[model samples]
Target: MIAFLKKRAKMSFLLLLKVLRFYWLLLNVWHFSRTKISYEAVKWRNISIYFHFKSKIIKYLTSNILSKINISLNSSNKNFSSYIK
Candidate 1:
């Protein structure tokens, strides 16, 4: 299994990633059936977790970038004033 992927990876990295994703999804489906769990439950949990992680990262980055922009603007304003005088 790993050896097959390694061979495909040498041919194309994108194809290798697709193969891995499909393999994992097949594994999850097999587990879900054995456990008699609702697929919707797993799907919901996965979607929520992905969204929560993305939102947190975006919010943190936005705040950081905004702060940096504000600092740059304030410094430039001071320089402009010195030039005018």
Candidate 2:
């Protein structure tokens, strides 16, 4: 899994965000359509899922960004050392 991500390192971050949004929307639709939904239950569920989804997106995007930044910085340092020699 990590290897696959490393291979596709050039994919745009916006695309990943769009994919996550799509999945979240699908889940939200499913939750809204539940036959057992009540006013209070729906409100509670919406609040919980909203926070859960927001946190997951933030965590994922930030992790990806940090990983990419680390990789880029490491590569630049390596190149700088080679250039100095």
Candidate 3:
């Protein structure tokens, strides 16, 4: 009886860890998705002064396009899923 309880406790702990890991992964992906501009800036930070300015411009353009695309895709996905349901 005690051994069975111990096994159940260990299984639950493992399941809890799995759930936490899944949530951690999702949060990491969300954080990365929101860091596009910062990523570009950091990428060019140590390279050169000239490229740093270029990176800022590229980052701004990229983030803008990405946000617009994300919005459109979300709207489209919602519409498509609505049809399916």
Candidate 4:
């Protein structure tokens, strides 16, 4: 009976650990979802400002990398420009 009780105690501990792990994951997911929703709820002007800065950084990085690689941004093809417009 003591052995059975010990086994039951071990099982209960494992179950408690599993429940704690599940709650931890649930909390993390809830936090991320809340963050995402709050970010999305931001004003369009603020979001655009964020994106504008992001694009500038990206453009700077790409331009520097491409220049290092000797790749020209200005293509001689007029057809490509027309197609883009």
lDDT tens digits, residue span 1-85, model 1: 9999898777797778789989978987987989878999778866898799999999999999999999999999999999999
Cα-lDDT of candidate 3: 0.82
Query: In terms of TM-score, which candidate is strongest?
Result: 1
Clashing pairs in 2: none
Candidate 1: segments with Cα more than 4 A from true spot: 1-20, 23-27
Runs in model 2 lying further than 4 Å from the true structure: 1-38
Q: List the residue pairs that clash in candidate 1.
A: none
Determine which window of 10 residues in candidate 2 has minimal summed lDDT: 34-43
* Better candidate number, 2 or 4, judged by TM-score: 2
Score each candidate by Cα lDDT: 0.90, 0.84, 0.82, 0.76
Q: Tally clashes: model 4.
A: 0
Candidate 3 clashing pairs, residues 3+ apart or interchain: none
TM per candidate comes to: 0.60, 0.52, 0.43, 0.41
Higher-scoring candidate on lDDT, 2 or 3: 2
- Model 1 residue 56 distance off true place after TM-score fit, in angstroms: 1.8
After superposition, the stretches of candidate 4 with alpha carbons farther than 4 Å from their true spots are 37-85
RMSD of each: 7.4, 9.8, 17.1, 18.5
Count of backbone collisions in candidate 3: 0
